[model samples]
Target: MHIAVILKQVPDLVEEVEVDSQGTDIDRDSVKWKLNEFDDHALEQAVLLKESSGAEVTAVALAADGVDQLLYAAVARGVDRAIRVTTASARTDAPAAAAALAGVLADMGVDLVLTGVQAVDDLHGQLAPILATRLGWPHVSVVSRVSLEGTEAEVTQEYSGGRMATLEVDLPAVLGVQAAPRPPRYVPISRLRQVMASAELGSAAAAAAAPALGSTVTRLAAPPQGQGAQMLEGRPEAVAEQIVALLRERGLVEA
Candidate 1:
């Protein structure tokens, strides 16, 4: 079986975020990019499946700063192939990115497409479903585990309220992975360097253009700070008395 894993590079949250002059977007040029955490889990899932079933795994990513390193890193971790798509614009919303990826996935004979349920930057959780729609393939989201037999796949998905549903999906399906069966193995820097120096990388042209989303951001601002915490320090009895008084003062308790 051939599987394609869509990888994304997202800005590390530790980096300071600043809105661009347009006020609708972030200033990408100033941000430090790293592999998206959820995508990291997705990659591990693909590698695990590949190891267990001898499936061919291809890691695909859009062209971007530090993407070559990410691809090489994947190769070092045992993915069989790496592909980088050429894209003109960096403003890839979930639908636009899915559209661009659809073109490349169509010709790759991808029996399974696995990616993160949501990117840290966008957190919209829209890419997998949209890509499946574009490909006319069945899709499952928030999938925690996947098992394959012959041409059928069984996936266990987690939902709100601690619920889970296991679905039997046919081949040529898409899954948005929420977690991997195991954590991703660490790849040494030397291994990554070896792949970067010698491993082959493939290139493809994405959809000619991305359609614009219907919405726009007018203003961007940080969330308002919450009320600061109050400290009660004393002997146990005194602290307890203070807490009771404060709660009664705030009408949280009947005096």
Candidate 2:
């Protein structure tokens, strides 16, 4: 079986984020990027399948800052191929990403596709469904486990409150992977460096124009800071009276 794992880089939250001058996005120039954590899990699942079932795995990502290194790392982790989709802008809405990916992936004739359930940048968690819609393929999200069987795939879907369900999806489906069965494996820095020097990444241009479904951000700003807590000292009776007085002052209780 052939599996295509979609990848994306997101701002490393450890680094402080600054708003760009445009007020609609973060300052890209000041940010350090890393592979989206969920995407890492998706890659792990693909690699696991490759190891267990002898499946061919392809890692695809948009051309962006540090993307070449990320693809090389995937190569070190057992991916068979890496492709970078060339786009006018690295930062795109989910619809645009899905459109570009679906166009290239459709021609590859992959048996299955996997991606993170959501990107930290957008958190829409809609890329899989959108890509599936564009490609006219079946799709499922919040998948935690996947196993291949002939032309179909069985997956464990996770729901809210720690609920899970097993589903069988026909081949040529897309899945939003919430996690792999196991934690993502580690690749040594030496191995990654070697792959970076030797591996070649295929490239493709962005597909047709993105639809008009995306929204325009008008403004962006930090949330307003609020007054900090006021400590209530003294006896329990005094604290209770203070609380009642404060609530009354705020119109939260009968005067």
lDDT of 2 by residue, 136-172 (tens): 8999999999999999999999999999899999999
**How far in Å is the alpha carbon of 24 misplaced in model 1?**
1.8
Q: Which pairs of residues clash in candidate 1, taking residues 3 or more apart in a chain or in different chains?
A: none
Residue 216, model 1: Cα distance from true site in angstroms: 0.9
Q: Write down the TM-score of every candidate.
A: 0.87, 0.86
| Worst lDDT 10-window in candidate 2 | 118-127
| lDDT over C-alpha atoms for residue 144 of model 1 | 91
- Model 2 TM: 0.86
Q: Where is model 2 more than 4 Å wrong at Cα?
A: 123-125, 227-255
Full-model lDDT for every candidate: 0.88, 0.89
